[model samples]
Target: MWFNWLTALTKGVLLMAIQIVTDSTVQLTAEELATLPITVVPLIVRIGNQEYFNDGQDITNTEILTHLINDTELPKTSQPSIGQFLEVFDRLGQNGDSVLCLSLTHFLSGTVNAARQAADMSATDVTVIDSLSIDRGLAFQVITAAKLAKNGAPLEAIIAAVDLHRSHTKIYVFLNTLENLIKGGRLSKAAGGIASLLNIKVMGEVVDGELQVAAKGRGKKFLNKQIDAVIDDIKAVSPAKVGLTHVDNLTTVSEISQRIKAALPETLVTIHEAGPVISTYTGIGALAIEYYTD
Candidate 1:
């Protein structure tokens, strides 16, 4: 009788199913994904005539950075095709599980639209959300939904909370060099050269689905300003999670993470390596911080 009760409990837990789907830009670690019911769809990374997938499992940011440092050419990135999204959706939909797919901002990439197209083709109930942010900012929304889903929350509740989370979440990026932006034709060479010569760092945030400059300064002034902004936000809001991501710049990221934790001792801080899609724009030695309110 006791054995039967334990078996029944296991079956009951298994029935409470919801799946999380996110793109490679979410930048979540392997260990974290193991604990949460999340599946990742990789973006495409191109260098010269070669192409690679930003799948968190096989391709990593470390390898991508190595190529950037050694090669003269800057890497390029693209959103996953609709067919790629369909493959993932069909697999996850096999068990009739409701899926919540979070994607990079529509302004930055067409990943969200691809997800939506796949959702319409999916057999199971699928809700695709435009996170309106990238990197860990996107991860925060996915993490929240996965947690709610694991606790047996209904699909509607999960979607509502995730939608709100994406709006409230904020991401701040610090670029040590403007070489990539200039190379990509997003910034003029003259302006990038001027900024580089002056040792100025660029800081930006994604607002209204667009990248906007939030702050800029040189050396310590720049670092302090960004850190101060984070500290101020924590003081005003109920801090749920903080993420520090860097492009092969762990030392600086660690220092910043320490300062953030020192300010809010109870908050959980996750450090991730920025993947190819983000690195393609930020260039080498870029770092970013993302957080959401409780």
Candidate 2:
């Protein structure tokens, strides 16, 4: 189905896409990036990175591929600026279709506001939604939007579903360090300053539209306890769709998945490497589990 879509997207045709900047799926090569119904925004997207876009085998550029293979990783920037997002909205407008953008948590980043600004000026119709969550946290919302657009669902309906689900979703996380949050300015001075004295570890979940701490762990072993809390919370909600994501730590993801399976075998759980943008705050050991419980 993905391959078919690529074939259909001929001649810089306008396309409907779900743009997300999370720890996982963000660094995919342009070819890898474009394969999804998604547009992966890096922590930083450079001016010339578009040259390597691999729309398909026929469209793949050897020079670009060569650069990609030789370079350690793609260069990224802060969440795309409002002007940058406008460019994408404008281009898609040429194809006579709107874009539905699913963004990471608003509390976590300013990316949503930037996207809204761009959409306001876009010639095409654009709906920017705040996932209000992170990790694969936003995956289902993105997937549904993409699927709806692919199946010719009206832009308005697609946007509505995205909005509805964004409100329904919940994200739970276990942070290995408050250092990442501190650096990202997420942790208050009281929280970060006493990180050492408190020997801080953060275990939190989003409920009623707020990031609230459920517990604090002092070290690695204690993180398991936090995971236990997460599982218990999930059990109470029993979401139909679920995912586990880690910034740079696949190890933690594996460990959590096994636990989730044991605790909630009926739920579907997907594991993903965190994309660069999300990692900026979540840190290497940052792990998040998200699902829809209602």
- What TM-score, over all chains together, does every model reach? 0.85, 0.71
- lDDT, candidate 2, at 32: 31
CA lDDT, candidate 1, residue 115: 92
Q: Report model 1's TM-score to 2 decimal places.
A: 0.85
In terms of lDDT, model 1 sits at 0.79
lDDT of 2: 0.62
Model 1, span 106-214: residue lDDT tens? 8778899999998998886788888888888888888888887777677777777887887788888788767677676545665455665665887877786566666
Model 1 regions more than 4 Å off = 1-16, 185-199, 235-238
Superposed model 2: Cα runs more than 4 Å off = 1-36, 45-77, 191-193, 207-210, 235-237, 262-266
- Model 1 lowest lDDT segment of ten: 1-10
RMSD of 2: 8.6
